[model samples]
Target: MKILLVLDNLSSSCGANVGIVYELARTWVERGHEVYCLTRKDRFHDIDQQKAGLLHMVWSFDVTEDDILNNVTKSDKWIHLSATGKAIFELTHPVFLQKMIDKKFCESSEIRNEYRKQIEKLFKERSFDAAVAVTEPFYIADALASAKVDTDKYVIMMDPYTNNPSTTDRTRKKKLAREQHVFESARKVFTLDFVGNDMNYLSEELLGKRVNFCVPKVKKCGAGRSDDGATVVDSEKIDFVYVGQLYEDIRNPELMLKIFTRLPDNYILHFYGGGCEQIVDKYKEILGDRLVIHGWVSSDESALAQQNAHILINMNNSIKNMLPSKLIEYINTGKPILNICQIQDCPSIPYIQKYPMAVNIMPMDNDNNIVTAMISDRDLETMAMEVQAFTENYQGKIVEHDVIENIYSDCISENVADMMLEEMQK
Candidate 1:
């Protein structure tokens, strides 16, 4: 069985799209399926390095940075854009800059052609049984879909590219024809979150093409439990660690900022991710060293931090359809998780509710009074106490048993491998 996966990074800590596909690809390899990958040169992970010799073949797209300090910003590897195009990107809000940077990269012909050639080369080497194209960068999917490979091609959209509310109408118009081709080229399409799955009608309406997007429940992670001694675990303190980007208006850290101060001084909150500039001082001023801010970390470093933390924190976007990518890593940690939902039906609730050591704090609910927004002092205090109680009482970790074992094998990856074997048998 031969399967080809297209994504940004194979690193679990890179984000959701990569992590989900990595677990799926890993399982297929362990089952003796031949798996190949095309990813960003800089975004490759060490986990795959250990498995590279016999397990798989990886063709990284190209270097996105001189060094990884470019990190999520992508400022170093950016080329081909006109001077004005680059200047306009500088003015984009820091919260949204990383995303726009990605869009800009996807707009590059040079990068796209390089990926197309590699995709063609791989297909030329052997006809793949299945081609799974994942997207945060929609162009990669476009490249994969546009390929002349005879395999059953599929597209996994971790984000709603044409329908993203943050994007302007002009951008959507520019991308619609291109993305419709990608979706139409695939045998099936998948979205990571169910909310997005429900919005397939919206995508179809926008694309002017038939589209059926299903949510694949591949949330289990096989990586990210390694403790490299990178984090200094304080046995005397209770630490609630949050990893991922922060937004000023959208994914604001106001709730996390308020909650930990209510706990005893021994309870601390550590933040790890980008877009921390606006609140770094505020974190110091309000919590005064109790809420530690770790601005940016490598994928390996991010894993170690989560492995060492007493509690993991996750926040859902208000869009309702967009789920946080960090939830996968948080679940993998097996640590008690404190998930703050910004809306009533936050997409992460279903997954969080299933975990034995997880709790959800939403904006409003009859059963829970957990919103940090303009609630009375009493409600705020009660919420704070509830967090402490939940944190202290959980003794069990979320182990491998919590995952749906047959999901990948019974669904996409396994189906791909089996169909190929069936064809060979014929």
Candidate 2:
């Protein structure tokens, strides 16, 4: 069997989507199937280099950052008339610029034509048995749909539809129409989380079939090790680690700041990913050295940090429908988790509850009101105590590598690959 995966970016390490794509390609290659990946030329080269053997072909377009930027500005002009459009431009103009830039580039007719021509060339080289289009930027899938590829095409929707703050009603309608077109054109649609169930209704309305659900899995990057060659459990400070971006709206760290500042001196909060500069700057005086910011580290370094930390922290405030990919990595560490999720029915709640060492705290004041009625100091102290107790309970217990592997294996890419193969056969 031959498979083609279309994506925007494929980083060398530390992304759940990239990990899934690599694992799927790996699984197919191990099974003697041919796998080809097509992404933008500007994507991290290390990813393609690292998986050279597994991927039969790693094709990239001549699209550059400047090209994407220029296209984004052109696209922005189309939406400039509306208040939402102006707000979207201002909010994401420079800081969160990738979202709009990628969207515009993907939706460009000229770009799609170029992609279609290249895809046609590839199709001429070898007949692809199936193609998986990850829905984001939504351009590759749209291009594939327009090209009328004969193979079994599958669309994987990783995120639910949220009304874009910067989009006009007309733009929103067009986006939805394009998504519906992609869904209607696919052999089958798949989602990484149960939140896609809500999209099932839309799929049924458009294509008379519901979307399928699959668990998003992470690759077993080896456990993180300390420089001094000692286990994290033996460390003097009780490390509470958080990895990934700290978007102000979605996954805010303000409440965590409130809790961390009040914690005992022995307890330190370490941030491993980017996008928390504002929070770090605001609390720099009070946090002092207790808050350690490691900016962005390699995948190995992140795994090592997770392995060393006394507790893994997840902050899911108000963001619904998507599961945090970092949770899989945290679980792999076999350390106690401190999940502060305000959403009552967050999909991660059940998983956290399943793990004995994990503590899920849904603060009473979780509404959009961040200023008023925040997580009280009393509750913060109580939660800190609970976290300490949870950590102490698993201090000496060694969770074998195999145990962690088994937990992740259930959702491994092999399972998803096999499922896709079965769907293709049908």
Candidate 3:
């Protein structure tokens, strides 16, 4: 099958959405299917095409940051209007109305009109067996609608609609409304979380479309295991590593600093990836030489850090049903993990809770409780064994080629008749 995947951007090693796209596209090509990934260009100009191991063609649409914010509401000040517009601009760029709205100031109709024209042009240029849209609010709605995709096209929405707490209510509602409009016409919608956890509230509440939950496969790294469950990181110093963005959502650097401050003089804590500016600055002062911030390393670097650390820490304000994709990398490292989050049944929590090497702590737990657990000693070998077993089990489940074949094939079969009729009638 020939598939066209549309996403926000494929530049960063930021989240699971891009990771899943990379894995899926690469696997499809390896299986001899023609895969074309359509995405926007980021600061890293060649990022989309440079995603290695994926034997697929990538096309970066020429849409500027200014294009997205041109006519958006001033009242919606809380949301990143420019960022939100950029997400949709790629697919709607060529349309004159959208162009006018993008370059000048026009009403929503003019913007959407131009957007529809560009979408139609995209459809005219290439015929895809399926179209997979990664999640956001309604990032793909106009594109999908304009594509006039025959029902056989797949619409995979990675996020539950209106779920970002940081977004403004107006933007969230608009995104949700767009999602519902698309859902009513789509054959199926996909999400990364368990069934009940996606952003398709209207699909369930009104349209009665129960979402298809697809578990994302972490990239296959031949991570080894130890029989006695003991592995050593031959480092000059004992290191505790936290691999996540410096963002408020996950890093929680302030809390991390407070927790690690109680540790002995020899132990060091390292930060990788980006996040909170103030917190990073404050930690630099107190920890002095003890804290190291590597700010945005490659996946290989992150993996190396995992292997080198005595313990890997994942701090989140809440976990709920969502699993931080980074947890999968930690699993691959076969190292002990210390998870700090609020939810009990988070995707990572259950797996980690069962393992001897994992210590899952909630925010409600006082500082002393966490400090005591961290200071306490345990059979490192036994813990390593548990981590090894968990990783092996997960890796065993992912058959890359098979997953791609099945998902795309299903996309083709599921909507053929409906899509054909819709397209032909038009």
Candidate 4:
């Protein structure tokens, strides 16, 4: 089988999109199928001779000047647009502002025309069995749809399209209508959704479209490295560790900061991620030594830090459609999980509610001023004891054995491979 794998920014170890695409590519290639990567940029350029031989780069991506692997198969046309010129137009009107920030970088007519040309040419050259595209940029899916490519098209919605929180109200109906057309050619729609059951990645299925949500295989890891002696947390203090980027517009920590003030002196906060300085500075000033902020660290180090934490803190993002990848990592630790939910029916709540050691700080009606968890009361003293019981309990004492065991097993899902393979066989 020959397959097309599309990525906006290609890297082996970067974003969730990259992880899924690379994993699928490697899986298919190992199974003796040829997989071609179509993308805008290649951060690593570490593709070996053997793998590069089986892969092709499509469209207007300048992978690297050093790549003599000659991954290009049929992308001959290129159209570049200047964001500098568009910057002035962005402030002129609401319409211009929407255009400036809307969807992706590949919205230009020249680029779309070039895509149509290259797409047709590429299909003419190679007999591809299937094409898989993931969204965020959405243009790759857009391009595939626009080209009307006669292949088994598969769209993996890494994030929602019209259902996205930031999508303008004016464009909602048009975008929703386009959603059906964009994925009209898709043989099977797949989603890397952490939330379970009956939910389409796109909230409403226009024509009652059926979406195939699949959980990928999570490789087992050895117990995380512990007892470094050198520490971010005192080990004496009750540590609440959060490991991921805290975006200002998306996943703000302001509410969490407010909650932090109510905690006891022994509880300290440790955050690990980058560009978080702006968002953390005000709160960090108040907390002082209580808040420990580390620059972005490697995945291994982040996991190690989480392993040492008394409670792994999960923050709800502003967007309801997407689930944080770190939440999945936290659940696997079998550690006490403190999930903060600011939204109604947060995606994380469903996953963690069943775990004995997990507690959800759910949103409340601020009329009376209170924050409630899965436990009985939301008072300061009640919250303190609940935190203590979960964090200070004996090794494995707080964790429900049945729940933890089930979670561990559920991580390795054959559903993804089975569904995708079934599509390929068809």
The order of the candidates by lDDT, greatest first, is: 2, 1, 4, 3
lDDT tens digits by residue: candidate 2, 1-426: 878887755657525666666766687787888888877654333344766556887787776553545455445354244667756665766733654544453455555666667777777777888887775556667777766567888776666643333346657777777777777777776766554655533644654433554554534434231224224464477777899877766676776777776667877888888664666678767988898888878877887787777778987746456677788666656667888775677768766665556777665555634441456777777766766676677643445545555655655567777776666677
Predicted structure with the largest lDDT when compared to the true one = 2
Candidate 2 to truth, TM: 0.81
Clashes of each: 0, 2, 11, 0
Candidate 4: residue 332 lDDT (0-100): 60
lDDT of 3 by residue, 1-426 (tens): 676666656665436666655665655665566766666553443363467326456665554442444333222331334656755654565554454554333224443444445545666877777666655424554456555645354455554445654446656666666666766666555555442464445644534443444344433323131223344443455666888865555335565565556555556778887657566778789888899988778777776777667777776544344455566556545566667654445456544553345665544433422332343333223333443354333321222333333433322222332332233233
Best candidate (score: TM-score):
2
lDDT tens digits, residues 55-115, model 4? 6544435433213212221112111224564455346556535433432332444434444
Off by over 4 Å in 4: 42-60, 63-118, 193-209, 214-217, 221-235, 275-277, 366-385, 394-405, 408-414
Name the weakest run of 10 consecutive residues (lDDT summed) in model 3: 218-227
What are the lDDT figures for the candidates, one per model?
A: 0.64, 0.66, 0.53, 0.60
Which portions of model 1 show Cα errors greater than 4 Å? 10-14, 42-48, 61-106, 202-236, 298-301, 365-379, 395-426
RMSD vs true structure, all candidates: 6.7, 5.6, 9.9, 7.9
Sort the predicted structures by TM-score, highest score first.
2, 4, 1, 3
